[model samples]
Target: MRAFVLLCLLLPAFGQYEEMWGDKDYLWDTPGFTTTKPKHKACLYEKESCGCCLMKKQTHRMEAFFNLTHREMKKDLMLTKMYIDDMRASRSAFSFALDKNDSTECLGPFSDDAGIVFRHEFLNLGNNYNPMTGIFVAPRAGVYSFSYTISSDMKRAACAHLQVNGEIVSEIHGQDGQDSVDSDSVVKAIKLKAEDRVDVILPKGCIICSDKKFSNTFTGFLLYATV
Candidate 1:
């Protein structure tokens, strides 16, 4: 009688500490984990009950350990991949001039604002700038540097505006009535988001004097990436 009493007491204690699904326990106070109260541990009625319970306890412990370790490893791998992808992000820089040859071209005194489509490519590292559109669409979110030079014929006005997303950011203007060309430039650093558009605009009444010497030009580069 004493041995049976001890087994009953010890089995309940073992279940409370070792089992994932326990009766009337803090983890399973609701009916979701269990449907009925346990009748008996069956150690006395069945020959293999105690052994099976012990084996189940060991198996549960191993499965829990393995699941936790696997989850931690997967989280670590995802973070490492994000870091590597950021390191390999593309670098952007482009420089262009108004004319490809020494011959002068009177590039505009339009009725409306005109975009300067560059004719010469000095450097284009990432192909982010489109010569056809006279626009530089940022590939990565970051601070960037933009510069422009406007050189105009003696009788015409030399002027250009730097615009981001159709909003004017800066301008370069110089004009001379004498028989000589005039020029001006402005450099600016601004933060931008990916796919943001940047361009040079020539006002309706201004003109740019262009030649092989890159007298009229626009340039830009990525200072750093923010995203």
Candidate 2:
């Protein structure tokens, strides 16, 4: 019946049909096991390998926010260039004169905050000597407009006073003389904080200094702001 089903599939349930070809070179090149399932292999994110590590992590977070906004804009432009170089050295006009016995000194040693000093003796107006001595530390409380002078071309000029920690807020005894611009000894509208100590006394000797004024003026004081 079809040769008895091909001799019952070449026999061999424990029998043989020429001993199953006697090994046939061990089934020559054998490799056959199929159940139908292995087919994954996917990974291609594109753009040259996983998108170059996500564009280098978004370019390092945009270069760390542009290096912290360029270090706070360079410290606010160096405190506005030292407040515009102290207002261009106080307007700048340029002046100096004094010499009779000739004397000069400028002190703001209370611990200074915003002090300025400018002394020039042409020839010792009176000679007693006390040209200018200041001590202003306050730079944050309120009110502050202190001025002083003591000139002498010889018309009538001498006596100028001021104090802060000591109290005597203002004064100007011997009036009128040399006159650069001190009809009343400029010490207007004053108030302060942050340290507080403003003094400007010019016993009597037409104090003159112009280049505007504010190269630290010798300790008179400037830079007023900040609550």
Candidate 3:
């Protein structure tokens, strides 16, 4: 009986020791239990969230860059268009001359004649010069160079004036007495506004002679556009 009681006491002590240091006491080693630290899990979640935010920031930055580039490109395109338009406006030019060959059929010697319109087109670029009206209408505000020539028949003297907007700028006169042909030419530069008129005028009693060789000629060209 005594030996039986001693064995029972030893068995209870062994059971107590097992309960204090059993597998169940170690939660990490238990089935279905996580070994990850809470701080470590939180750090991983934060890192993943930050990565997503970084990607979004990069996407926004790229979009902004492209938008800026597109705006700049549009501005440049507008500027290019403006430049092309300016170049076209600056290309105004014209030249014309009389084609009358017979002195009897020549234009002029009229009462208050505004000058004979050349009625001929040698180089009417931009069509600014009107052959019928004998006038050049400035296409834009710019400096222009005008040149004209007048020829007189033998024993006859002819005089003409280059006029801008009805104001005289220069004049040409030719006189010959010995049965010889005489010619006079004049060149002048003037600043003009758009629609300003330029023409040659034959004062009363003035006569000009020309032949198929276009002895009486008028020419003008845009030096540079001011507008």
On TM-score, the candidate that comes out on top is 3
TM-score of each: 0.62, 0.26, 0.72
**Higher-ranked by TM-score: 2 or 3:** 3
The TM-score, computed over Cα atoms with residue i paired to residue i, of candidate 3 is 0.72
Tens-digit per-residue lDDT, 90-208, candidate 3:
68778777765543345567788556688767788788988888888999998999998887664566779999889988977665465566678898999999999999998777777
Candidate 2 differs from the real structure by a C-alpha RMSD in angstroms, to one decimal, of 24.7
Error of 1 at 151 (Å): 0.6
The C-alpha stretches of model 1 lying farther than 4 A from their native spots are 1-85
- What lDDT does candidate 2 reach at residue 24? 33
- Local lDDT at 226 for model 1: 91
lDDT comparing candidate 2 with the true structure: 0.41
Error of 3 at 92 (Å): 1.4
lDDT per model, in order?
A: 0.77, 0.41, 0.72
Worst window of 10 by summed lDDT in candidate 3: 20-29
Each candidate structure's count of clashing pairs:
0, 39, 1
Scored by lDDT, the top model is 1
User: Which tens-of-lDDT digit does each residue in 1-227 have in candidate 2?
Assistant: 45444444434332422332343322222355233323331112222233333233333333554566798899889999988985553321222222223333322223323323434533222122234633445534544444454433334444446666766666655455545333344435566564666555454333322332221122233335444
